[model samples]
Target: MDPILLGAIFITPIAAIIIIGLIWYQKWNYTFKDLQHIKGPTPLPIVGNMSELGDPTKIFWQLFNWQIQYGNIVKGCYGMDMLLLISEPEYLEFICTSQSTLPKGIFYRYLHKWLSFGLLTSKGKKWHQRRKMITPAYHFKILEQFVEVFEKNGNILVEKLRGEVGNPSFDVNIYLTLCALDSINETAMGTSVDAQNNSNTDYIRAIKEMNRIVVDRTIQPHKHFDFLYQFTNDYKIEQKCLKILHSYTLSIIESRRQELLNNPSRFDSKYVDEFGMKKRIAFLDLLLQSTIDGKPLSNEDIREEVDTFMFEGHDTVSTCMSFWMYLISKHPEVEAKLLAEQREIFGDDPKRPTTYLDLQKMHYMEMTVKETLRLYPSVPFMMRDTLEDFTFRDLSVKKGTQILMLPFYLHRRADLYPEPEKFIPERFTAENMSKRHPFAYLAFSAGYRNCIGQKFAMIELKSTLSKVLRSFNICSAVPEHNLVIKSEIILAAGNGYKIQLKNRTW
Candidate 1:
């Protein structure tokens, strides 16, 4: 071989080995040493505690046990990457409340391909601007207008349950989910999706498939890397789902844009209802009319928010409603008290449309929802990326570390909630709440990035449940102990929420 070629071959291999060694040292040596003080399950060589996540179906329980075994804060790893799992209320309060702890970590990136920068995944100045712009869409006044949509859907749900009355253990999940989709689409997209009417829309199916893929990816740590995940069939399926979802949202945006162009007066806020009162516009219209620093939201920007709202708005509240109904069925005394309150508010009218004032008066129902959330938060856990070097009590975390906050475990802490496993709505009464830590309960999360649609969700919950309760008495077929639960971004019962509805004789 020529002298130059021989020299190049030797040096290149040596340099490559050195580079790999340094990368390994940084990840395995330095990172592990820095977090050695924090208590957690021991990690293996390259995989770390990745396998500790074991079966995807049982991962939630494993993590819950770990949260107890390792104390409020435990350090774990996926490969050399570190994670700080937290269930402490004070620590959680700090993490959520502080302005600096806003950027979501790598996990949320999984949702980005679907959600884009629509509030849930956006960060920094862009997030702030979007938050401000979209804030008005969920305002109390705006949500008040959505009451008509909620009422229509609530009545639809009640009527649909008529045939199922006295049935033995029918799953209500599909019914509630469809009702939510219809209500949210009408309010969020300026149109009716007719999901409750059983419209076989690809968009709805895509949403369900996309959520399953996200859960699959999350539980399988090896699929975290894009390079490897790209080769998997799930990724291909996810792409197809995204196409359907995006196409649907884009079409809606185009339709609304054309409608506004043909009738400029529709863009104006002067339209009066039959009562001569100005009607509130759809969420899509609000986004179209909004300007942030002189620029209106693009179709893409508007689509992201619309898609985000569609995903977040419907399933979350619907899931909560499912549990709310199940819990009521399990506790007859609680249901009796709840029915009494509803009767007091609306009198004997089973078809009374729930108003903003009526929803506000459903105080006990709100507490029951709160207690249900404490046991089963819609979004079970949240992750945040460290923006800077951080310290927690005796432990230190470097910049770029991922933080996992577990509201599921925190809400059930024995120190905070006295019989943590019991179904007690009175635990949230004003006096009891005042005595507890403000951050002890985080049903819709907490702090700056806390759920923007919380008020809207609460109203939807009360309205839907109030309507159903007025017409039918709900009972669950499965006992609380018999229910098998799992976490998939949102908590779900593995066997489904099976219940029987009996028409109220009064």
Candidate 2:
């Protein structure tokens, strides 16, 4: 072979490589110019900033550090997707109150299969119609019926704590979660899951597993693509989980649909039983009768709303209440205040169940719950995609950019809340809250797309906590098991909510 021929072959390939590299650099520069002013951590070639966010358990805190080091509107990446995490109050208010009605950001794509076009995941006309129809289901009259469910479930929880009264400490997360599951299921589906008694039930297991998988998939970028995900074992497990979740939800929908045919007026209005008491109407019963564009909602459509209710209702309340138990335990003064308030409402009869009026009288507990939410919100963060370009805080965000709202850190801002890390229920007093930014505390999120079940969740939490505090005294673990907070699809405690209980002697 001639030396000239060999040189020509090697040189040609090297020249091509240079040309391709230059073309790629030019494209990257052009795209980033719109966001050129935004400051953020440097990204790697393919994974972007995912290496820094490698651990799901610590990603939220990691992002918080980035926000502090970079700025309030920290620009970063999740794999190839750009994520703009906002903590500034003005920016949060603008994004939330304006474009929130836009579809949920990319993170919700994974939830579509399980929750699917439910009020949480739906967008556009579908979301508007569904929101209109679903609003009535959570009416004061309808919600009034759920108080009985809460009390009955709360009593079961109080009775169950008897077995753990003498133990030094145990993870009470499961107890609270199952109790919530039982209560939400009874109200949402009108079926008795009795999750507290049968903790090993399939529905409960599937929900737990699905929660893990949603977080798992979010962090692992490769799983984002269905084509790539289908080849992995997690994909298989996800399918199995979906089968259990959807089948059970659908089964109850069908059962209730058939049951309604026999009664035909269950959803008409809350009817009175022979005992002259108003009967309860489950969330599912209302959805069964609802229609979209004059066509009755299909079973699939009804299941979407019911399943969404289960996730939001049970997971949101349980996580918040669990934190309250831990926070209340750590601050004995807080616990004393809570118990005193309980007495004021129930008049020394702690065993008496709470009514709607009773929940209203829980002014102190309401403030405490609000403060707990500020410290550790039920949903740690909310994600949204901008439908139109917007400018805020002198920063211009492009359309199609993903906005990750970090309520976890927003509420932690020292500038916003003095001694932000401390448990101060008074921070939520009428006077204090009025002085604060409305968007500063986003436990239930903000704006048009805020959590629809907010009132329902508050009622369940206050009633349940009132019942538990009345019967038992919750104390922190002997060795001090600190809650390792993690932001998953919902806020989660990696270490579990560990506490001891003593039978109330008052």
Candidate 3:
């Protein structure tokens, strides 16, 4: 054989082997062996189940249906990526509580970058430090100070409803959103946003824009590629929202800095006067005065914390209020009972908005609110990633595997609550609550990273509902419309909830 011919033969075989090996590796790399045991719908090549997942209208129901088919713990693929959907309470508890094992998922990395290391997005030691620093701000004693703000906002809502009495139809979502915005602004930033007054504040607009962009990003298939965000419209919107939000937060911090400088005594813990009651007003003020290891919070720290609170403070509470109103409108008996409870508590005081002490007395109202959360938790699902190899039900979850815990399904488990679909507030009564698992009714989630603003949100809901129910009778404007539920960071009614407001005769 000629030398050139022999050399060609050897090189051709080597190249063929290399190509075969590369192809084999690619196929193996894309496969998920562990998920073989768990049954799910056949996923399409490349897209996997992403086509089904991207359908915003049917995604939740589709997932719920999958849960029914594949049992509580179903494994599915999304574009070559594996996801474990955990619906069982026990599994959820393990995922949520096992922070040392499971951290927030990589999908949330974008949020972490945008929002900074705040309680909602931060993980590991940083999350712990931030939570510790902020926990005291939400203690019952501190939250009590914001009762008036809640009442004022609730009263504003009532006045708005009263003005529209006999209108036969109106969209309540916008109003609820505005009420939450105003209340959060006053409580969290110590600055009045005047959202209920229809003021188009840049901060409020930006917040709304951010939510819209987030929803768009979630639903749009092409936006899933993180690198592509820079060249997309969603990125532009997100950037705009971030700018307005950050600017507003920084401006508030600067104003507070000036105020602290002008009145050094404002930071004094012993500035009590005649009544012997210490007056530490405002959320920003409290945060500013808070120190860890005797070091004041840095501006960056304040901005991140404030932004987190502001984002959460408005969205979750507002979404809950909107759903609660819709539920009450559908159930007149429940509404009547709520009204009677309100009347019994305040006793015909026309000017009496719920006081902090008064809210404490509204036990029935609390039950109603709890039940509402159980049925329509503003946050339907939460994502966590495995930080280390951990065993769940004898199966190992390797580091970096995404874990999705759906509270929506868990809340509706028939075994946990008989006839779970039935709207029964009594399920949350003290007696009934004691019999269930502590993590079963986790509307605000469970364990160390549970919602810090849960108390404030509860108080705000109770106060607002009491005032609204006391003053007006609300009924759905279009009862026939099947209201679609969608999640874009928070659960919201797809078609804005419309209600008829009638002034209460009683």
RMSD of each: 3.4, 3.2, 4.8
lDDT of 1 at 309: 92
**Residue clash pairs of candidate 3:** none
Per-candidate Cα lDDT values, in order, are 0.85, 0.85, 0.78
| C-alpha TM-scores of all predictions | 0.93, 0.93, 0.89
**Predicted candidate 3 versus true structure: per-residue lDDT over 1-506, tens digit per residue:** 99999999999988887776565445423334544566677765455678888876777777878888887787765664557787776766777778654466655655654578777888777777778888788878778878878888888887877777878777788888899889888888888878899758787778777776765666566877778878987788788888878888899999998888898786564677568867556778877887877898887788888888888878899888888888888888888788788788878684675678888888888888888889889888877777776777745565656777778888888988899987888898899999998878778988766788888888888878788887788787777855678777788888877788887776
Predicted structure with the largest TM-score when compared to the true one: 2
Local distance difference test, candidate 3: 0.78
- TM-score, cand. 3 vs. native: 0.89
- Ranking of models by TM-score: 2, 1, 3
Candidate 2, which segments miss by more than 4 Å at Cα?
A: 1-34, 273-277
Tens digits of per-residue lDDT, candidate 2, 409-456, equal: 899999999999899999999999999989999998888888888899
In candidate 1, what are the lDDT values of residues 189-217, reduced to their tens digit? 87887887865788788889889888888
TM-score winner, 1 or 3: 1
- Number of colliding residue pairs in each model: 0, 0, 0
